[model samples]
Target: MELIVDATPTATVIRVMATRIDAPTALQFKEDMRAITAGFDGRIILDLANVEFIDSSGLGAVVASMKQLRPDQSLELAALQPIVEKVFRLTRMDTIFAIHASADHACAAGNT
Candidate 1:
């Protein structure tokens, strides 16, 4: 899993480099996310712009990543492709996480 980690004063933006987040990549995704978010103090924006698909396991991994975060920190998802977004909607996960139109929008929304 190749994750482009961008660190800003506002948030650590992690852009997924993979096209599909299916069962095969779910475990690696979790590990990468855990390692990526090990010490950040600001908001965490998961930029899924390039991700075109996500399976149930992938969704579970994303949810688990959120649960693993420290109490003071938050995880927001951004730039979800249509297919991926549909899965989130079908699973009612859109209600659980703050979804943004784009990574820039999420960054512009707040720094804290």
Candidate 2:
């Protein structure tokens, strides 16, 4: 699980460099997210533009990531592929987190 971290004035954008976030990479994805988001105190946007697939474990990992965040910090998602977006929608996880069209759009929305 290769996650690229980009810090902006408003949020930290972590881009999923891998194409899939399934059972095999789920643990590593959560671990990496913990390490990368350790000190961040603002909103964190996960850019999933490159991710084409996400299984149940992957979805669990994403939810776990949000659970591990500080109370003041938040985890949002952006640029999800249609398939991935469907998973979130079908699972009703879409209502749990704020989903943006893109990382830039999330950033533009500010801390709201």
Give the whole-model CA lDDT for all candidates, comma-separated: 0.93, 0.96
Candidate 1 lDDT over 31-60, as tens digits, reads 999988987866899999999989999999
RMSD vs true structure, all candidates = 1.2, 1.0
Off-target runs (Cα >4 Å) in candidate 2 are: none
The positional error of residue 50 in candidate 1, measured at the CA in angstroms, is 0.5
List clashing residue pairs in candidate 2: none
Worst 10 residues of 1 by lDDT: 103-112
> Residue by residue across 1-112, what tens digits does model 2's lDDT show?
8999999999999999999999999999999999999968889999999999999999999999999999999999999999999999999999999999999999998856
Against the hidden reference, what TM-scores do the models get? 0.96, 0.97
| Candidate 1 clashing pairs, residues 3+ apart or interchain | none
Candidate 1 to truth, TM: 0.96
